[model samples]
Target: MYLAKRLSIQLLVLISVVTQQTTAQPLSNKRLEVSEKHLLTDLITEAISRDEWMDANQLFVSSLQAESIKSGELDNLKLSLGLANMPIDSLDFNQEAMTQLKFSVSQMLPRGDSLALKKETWQQKGQVALVQQYQRAAQIERDVSLTWLAIFEAKQSIALIEANRGLFEQLLEVSQASYSSALGRTSQGDIIKAELELIRLEDRLASLALIEQAKYAQLGHWLGDLESWPEPNSLPQVALKQARFYPADPVHFDDKSHLDNKGHLDEKTQTPNHSITDQTLSKQFVQHPNLIELDEKAQLAQVSMSLAKQAYQPQWGLNASYGYRDDAENGMPRSDFLSLGVTLDMPIFSKTAQDAGVKSKQLALNAIAFEQALALKQMLAKYRVIQSKVAKLNQRHHLYQSSLIPQLKQQEDIFLAAYKSNEGPFSDVIKARIESLNAKIQALVISVALQKQKVEFNYLFATSNDFLLGADLVAPMSSY
Candidate 1:
């Protein structure tokens, strides 16, 4: 009996060690150190810097700059030279037949600041490209962060399963030994069940290995070569930024609100206090890069509309010419002629075309406004949904940490002790142990999921410097 108790104690110690190895790191509060060697932020920075799409966008901005420069030079001075022989014979009383050369210079002056408006429109387009680049960078950061977390989760799950495999092996050994010795309620059936469970654990390990490989492939889309990439052994805790419009103390609906005398709920009492409104969400979303990009586009459209309106005014031209004539047929010298003129084109015949252009631009600008509104609505809705998910995951994580995990662990210990003393069926021991392992894995899943949601939530708060990490927004790859 004393020997049996000693064996049971030894088995408990081994089980405890394995469980500690599996759950300790995930449950700890240690933060991963950020450095040049760190994976998460460094990977994000690298991905943004090396992104071909961002490089292409920067080139587009450069093209816009060229367009802006071109717009400014549209009304520059023009010069021309002409050589011709005067046809004096056709005139009734021509004084001479002469070869003439003419030199002329002309300048077009655009009506009503049209040139300036055109330049400004191109400049506004460049600004929009810049905003979109930053927005794309933020999206890349979110994607890399999520993929990294997924790989980490898979690695940790594999570790937990491998750690628990030792306990399962020990159970199989005990069942086989007892059945061979014809001892204490141990049967061939228990041995078979133990073997089956071990096989299942092996199958789980293989599945997790495949999942980890797939995640690595996904990560490679951003990080490039995975050949030298280190397996993720630690999870970096992402800092959660509180949304600008999030209430400090959120409101909840009160089902027990006092009813009016007429049996309807009081309107004033029914209203939840500290509730966030659509206006507040809109105000927050306006600061996001996606919305800001749309805003810039709208401004560009407005400038274009103003430029189109300038087409209604007349365009003016000024020219000066000096013409030289050779000696006439009678061998007499002829005087050179000088001329000056001012010309303008009336828009009387182009009223329909100009109106149509202006109307088209106006409708485009209005369309941008509608796009902004729709995008804001979608962002607000998505934000609310993710916020709810984060809250629920947090609650579940707390329940696992404080109540479910501990109870499962205790139950596992109880069943193992009972099985050793022949007071419980071997199947009960296996069930309890499986439940405990699953609970631990579930807890880890919740933790990883919470962090991923936080990463995504913080991404919604797009500012110029949000994910820039001190890198220049316009030239993100320069430092690299």
Candidate 2:
């Protein structure tokens, strides 16, 4: 009787497990919705809200300006011997000698007064400080934009991978069923391969998740807190939804329309490429903040040279003294005496030192000029490279959207149908699916690259004078 009860219990447990497995639902891609503008606003607001020491570049510049303004006052004249030298007689010896005292004042002035030069030096230094502040602002904008884009790229990659999960599962189901019966077209090896591919996708998703976390941490450093960031899944879904709306070319295969009923690509009118070329970019290069800063630096160096040359000029001074004395032994009081004198320094002996200083300053000015030219050339070269890269990525985008992706999709469908009809190996279907998925992944990579290139151009061109990073305002890469 006990044996019979055990058998009945085992049967019931087996039935329950099979029921759960059969009813289990496949995992679906999570929707991510994000607004670039909103995210940027939040990030910038948080960055500015914090009163950190590192963010005080502008304040430091203001302080330097105040210092320069205060430098207008020169050094005070020397009051030489204001306290008179008094000579006293011996107390016990009682010599008839009378006490005498003397007082004097003196001042030294430059032959070619360089006070103005010194003041100008301070003013130029203030200008340099202001330029440095602007540079810092630009760097901050660059860093923030790069971090934000990195987060976007990682999220998009993970989403693309997730979107293919259903396809992977469907393939796995076919392979499993075919392998179970020797008469089926697919073998156990194909099932194993499908299983491995699924595992690879999961591994890739995990790696992308870690990368996403790191990017969030970097952004949070600027944002002041991680808690303020939206969920990782939220932004990607919005981006994916937008991508779904993006148009792709219609390909005719076997007299059937493979295009999604929801959207269609317009080949006649290409979507405007949001890339900036050297010719189309602003010709007003003078307004670039970096160039402005370098110009100020050069001015500062020139002023320094002028100040150094002032060392060759002579310096002059004046001195005056007064003496009061008591009467002699005859008791006749002596009148107060006054003396005046003038002093001058030709600086003839120090000509070599002054010349050396002037030469040093001149060299510094020349160095800055060379640096400016070199920097400009380098910047132009970088712009050219970035321009070429953007153009190339644009072409690749079209090729993927209009050709490779469509072809792969058709191949996948054909292989899938062939396997179902027992006319092809399941391995072919798996390969087609992987190839199609890879094309999608490649499309995503190019889109993000194009967007990143756009960001670089915006920064390099100084498209916006405002502190806000304009990269956030740009739309995603255009689609056919």
Largest lDDT belongs to which candidate?
1
RMSD of 2: 11.3
Q: Could you tell me every candidate's TM-score relative to the true structure?
A: 0.79, 0.75
Task: Give the clashing pairs for model 2.
Answer: 32-237, 32-238, 33-234, 33-238
lDDT, candidate 2, 1-480, per-residue tens: 533543554454344323323322443222113354355534544453442433465566667667766665655677644324333443321123333466777887754647777777888877776555445555555566667667777777777877887788888886777677676877778888888787777667666666666666666555544443453332221111112322331111111132233223334314333343334333444456787788888998888888888888888888888866657656665677789998888898888899999999999999988987777776667666764565456567777888889989999999989988989988898889888988887887777676566556545644224444221222222110
Q: How accurate is candidate 1 locally (lDDT)?
A: 0.73
Backbone clash pairs in model 1 (N, Cα, C under 3 Å; residues 3+ apart or in different chains), count: 0
Tens digit of lDDT per residue, candidate 1, span 365-445? 999999998998888777777756654565566678878889999999998899889898898888898999999999999
Distance (Å) between predicted and true CA of 23, model 1? Answer: 32
Most TM-score-accurate candidate: 1
The Cα error of candidate 2 at residue 133, in Å, is 2.0
